[model samples]
Target: MSATRRQMLARTGAAGAGIAFTGAISELFAGTAAAHGRAGYGPLVPDPKGLLDLPKGFRYQVLSREGENLRSGEGKVPSNHDGMAAFGGKRGGVHLVRNHENRVTAKIGVPTVKGLTYDPAAKGGCTALALDRRNNVIGERVAIAGTAVNCAGGPTPWNTWLTCEETEDKAGTNGYTKDHGFIFEVDPVDPHRTGAEPLTAMGRFQHEAVAVDPRRGVVYETEDAFQKPFGLFYRFLPKKPQGGRGSLRAGGRLQAMRVPGIPDLSSIQEIGASFDGVEWVDVPDPLAVRTPIRHQDFGPKGVTHAQKLEGCYWGGSSVYFVSSFARKAEGSAGDHYGQIWRYDPSRRRLTLVIVFGPSTDIQLPGESPDNICLAPAGGLMVCEDGGGVQHVYGVTRRGDVYAMARNRQNIGTPDNPEWGEFAGAAFSPDHDTMYVNCYAPGTTFAVTGPWHR
Candidate 1:
């Protein structure tokens, strides 16, 4: 690594949740772009292959492509790859549970395997890819099947993947035989442990992602609704908190977060602004049999709502989540390009860590940050889901931003040239490789480099 990157890493490791850390992040969002250096590897060197562009010393390998026959011979690889999680496997290898965000009408859906199908008519779910220590794909198969619009989910402390359905399509609607929108657990190591069963107790309505608090076994979830009244941040209090696999299936209480005076998260503009005494309001109906969770009445002080709530993960003692963006034109109460909020369970506080752009510049580091994961080298890797060019960004602990990779392939016509969004964004168990997926023409990539220790 360069001296600049080394210093940045050292500083990131030493920084804590204090004034210094807050101020650095504030400057980043306040348009003081001059304060940041190329804290990561360096500027992205264009890919000669015209696919993914990465830094000079970095390289990426394509592991799977949509429409291709699976090695397992079950069917073709599914399309619209989304959320994912990586776990340690046998002999220092890695296992990745990946989501296929296919709607009921998609041409190539996750293959239905015996015992894995939740709804034979539904066309979305997850698949597992086992890679050797050197990152070579050894096995791939359908992990969970027959779910709808499986978007993004978090991993459990006990070594399982929670695949979420990001839809509200009910039974008999659009050919769905059962209610969609619920979280399902998948065992990447043991296929027998992954039964395609939905955790119904966890309120459903377009779930985008989830974060599990290891200490309390609470699952924090985000909703990505496009209509007015948007989506709410939720937490599922499981009856068998911390019980190994199938615990969530036992059912739980679902509740949404409410900040005293703030009705919408997008209204908050100040970075490091903390809200204390945040409360949770129970969802009267987790199943959304009639009204969606966010649309349901939460008594006097209504449940707090935010637009484009996506990407959530637990780190340290806090659970961090993202609001992709908001606009008054889009029925949002307030406007901003993106916001990353951290909530401390012990203190019951929610603080705004970073906010970026209401600008037209797609080059802004915080433009539509989605599917975020804390980098092992002391930072956060954010997948950009905004307009123009899409990039995977690295935000240092001190809030410096750098582009880690760029999507250069044009999946659309030459006149349109559409670059699909990047999703998943997980690191291998060994931290030597980063794995992420391209949502269009569906593709999975394993990236390796001279990472900073």
Candidate 2:
């Protein structure tokens, strides 16, 4: 998904994927608010390492580097590391599940396992890295294979990853024998030995990410489709996801979000738009072999649609998701940088939490939030995949945004941005270290500092 995840957001002289980057270009250290507004994590000090620039007193360690051979000896390190999450492990160690969003090609691809292969011809899947307390990788291997476009997935309290497929490829295409676009579970402890079976009950679409409500076992999904057809926000009510390994495999009701007052949530121009309770109407045929799931099912129920639903994570009793960019041409009244919304299940209300304005330049802190993860320091952290110098932004508990880290790696790239789009920015369970991905020449960094508690 190099084109879908990174190039799509940064493409300006192009259109078609998601939002195009027609804005002016500027240097990373030139803009005021664009470079970084305030000292939320203290001012970013240029790094001597030349890989990443962090704030004063903060430093980063490389956990995994692309181009290195895989631990499983399956293939070289996978690129386009998109969505990821951290889990607790032995004696302060952590188990990190990373997603490789590579497309199908013959020679180069992500590693695949025999029994767990979904599409032998496909290359997209995920890997699990075992890191010790000091934040050093102890093990790394292909966790899930045969899936297509493993963009992002949520970690379950049951200690598993629900890796998602961002492509809607069918069987017999590109040498594929199985229909793609479904979620699969991977065990963090035994990622290489987990099940690759698609959670078919949870509709098949161009899925981006998922947020699991640990308390209810309900899985909320975000679709990364275009506005012409519009993407649908869905939830899966697993019949037996009562914190078990094969729980979601039981299959349950799949439904789309229907806001009672807002017919099309994307059309609302307001920043802090609010909507009373949402309805979840059943999606009769989620397999979507013939009819697209959003059109035939969601359209009939008048389910509210968003521009391009991307990152989704469960935190603070709410499922926070990203709607990358909305424009008037796409039926929305006005064009905005992007929006982040929080859906509170208990209150049964959805609140717009964050929104980005038009970028002054295609540079470092440009908006269009993609993958999101909770900072160990009590706030939300978003990976910027929009045009400009990509970064991983931090959102305070009080709603203040700050530039946490800048993509200062791969200094010799031909790309104007120079740095790769940030992905998989997640913190360890111990709250001592946070991990991030530099997309293309895939690199994973473990950053630690005096994080705000």
Q: What tens-digit string does per-residue lDDT give for candidate 1 at 1-453?
A: 321222111112323333434453432233222223447776789888888999898899999989988878999999999999999998999999999999977879999999899999988999899999988999899998999999899999999999999999999999989989988999997766768878889877899999999989999999999998999999989999966888888888999999999998888866667999999999998899999888898998998899999999887678888999889898887777788888998999998877755434554344788898867666678898988788888876565567789998898888878889999999987778999999986999999997653
lDDT per residue as tens, model 2, 71-141: 76877887778788889999999998889888875234677777767787888888889988898888888
Per-candidate clashes come to 0, 4
lDDT of each: 0.83, 0.75
Displacement of the residue 54 alpha carbon in candidate 1, Å = 0.7
Error of 2 at 13 (Å): 28
Q: lDDT of candidate 1 vs native? A: 0.83
TM-score of each: 0.92, 0.87
| Model 2, backbone clash pairs (residues 3+ apart or across chains), number | 4
Point to the candidate with the largest TM-score. 1
> How large is the C-alpha RMSD of every model relative to the true structure?
5.2, 7.9
